[model samples]
Target: METAVASAASTGRAQTSRSRCRMSPKRYEAKLRLAEAFVRLVEAMPAERITVNMIAEASGKHRKTFYYHFADKEQLVVWLFRYDLASGLADKFPEDLLVREQDSPDNPLAEFPFYARRIEESGRIYNAPFFAALSYSLEKRRAYYRRIFSTRGPGTLDFYLHQLFFPAIKEDILFLIDREIGRQSAVERKALRERMTSNAGVDFLAEFYTGAFLSRFVERLNYTSARRTARDIIPFENVVHDSLAALIRQEIEKAAREPGSEDRPGKGGAPCASPA
Candidate 1:
């Protein structure tokens, strides 16, 4: 009896391990199909109009398969926004453009146009469908975000913004500031850090960048036209680069003035420091 029980336990463990396997190619492809289907449907109809059955049919998978993979439609929507869209952008955009190399002397923001030009030139990269989906999340989908922002939904608007739109922009901006201040004497660096991390300091950096740079960028990109999109690339790039640089300079200047309040960053690399 003891020997039989041991064998059965081993078999059960093996089955559990197999079920928990990391996403294989087949699994990833299925998820991608679902995400693409959701994106397509979202463009044609409001999110509230979309149904799980529609998504499953569009992806050519059964509704049960979707349930097996995702808990519900909301879960699927979050995954599409958080992982699928972010991953696609990361794959297409140059990751190195967002960070400063120790030896490079050029402005970090200067690299924005270089990559922006790539997306503009590639017919398929920032094409109509792609731009529609991206801009809608930032623009048309404001109502959905506002709802979650006001109350506790599965995720937060702040997170959706960070993961979807602000990842590279936030990283580069913070890195530029870090390098600039890092050269200062230890005393100045410490003082600046504290000032930037304080309450008054927090509002200056966070509100300016998110409200100014990010918000304006999305608003400008909301329009969809091939001719206008090409024309807007350089201007949009300038807006992004200039706004971030301006924000950094403003914060640095403020830090210089205020000895009491300094800025530390947030857990997810947001400009705002967490409240004490």
Candidate 2:
């Protein structure tokens, strides 16, 4: 009896491990499709106005399928933004950035084999996880990030951030911000221990810009949704980018002039601190 129980327990653990494996190609494609669909829906309507049923319809997937992948709509928002920051969307696609750029696109080659991109050339992005990630074909690549850059409509980071402040997803945004700040604090603490140049200013700068952009964005959304006379909030995007960059440069220099901030950096690498 004891021997039989041990064998069963070992078999169950093996099955559990296999079930948790995220390396499957199927899961990757499915998740990408769902994410793409969510981007489309949120672009046309505020995130708070979207529903699981709507997302399912947009994705052409069954309602139950969504639950199998995520607990709720809020999970999808968090997952998308987390993926955005992690995948270097904020860095690679900064044309839509509301304030300033701080990061860059992650290199897919770092994880995949050298031939991984070649495998993607089978003329179908969905052929492999690597192609969806590493393909240079902009049209084909749209499956992953085509919608991320429009400040006006689709994949606009402004829309993404603007919707977060709405009541519908307030808790979700709070959870994400808390987690991000926690991660930043951990990184800063780790850098302090190692005596390295810490990116301590990143979190503060991100907070400053996010707060600034959202305040204006909230007014835009409110005015539009109410059918009021609309003035474009960010008519000239390059101008906004340049203006914000200059403002930060001014402020950082001003801060450094303060008595205790002599050691603080007056400017960062790149106009936005990409470090290269």
Question: lDDT winner among the candidates?
Answer: 1
How far does residue 31 in candidate 1 sit from its true spot (Å)? Answer: 1.9
TM-score of 2: 0.30
After superposition, the stretches of candidate 1 with alpha carbons farther than 4 Å from their true spots are 1-27, 82-159, 162-174, 183-187, 211-214, 217-222, 227-238, 250-276
Instruction: Give the alpha-carbon lDDT of every model.
Output: 0.44, 0.37
Shift in Å, residue 241, candidate 1 = 4.5
| Model 1 lDDT per residue over 124-212, tens place | 12233333334434444443433333432225333334323333333345545665467566666765654444344433454455445
Name the best candidate (by TM-score). 1
RMSD for each of the candidates: 14.0, 16.7
Report residue 55 deviation for candidate 2 (angstroms).
7.9
True lDDT of residue 156, candidate 1 = 38
**Residue 8 lDDT in candidate 1:** 21
Error of 1 at 54 (Å): 2.8
Q: What TM-score against the true fold does each predicted structure earn?
A: 0.51, 0.30
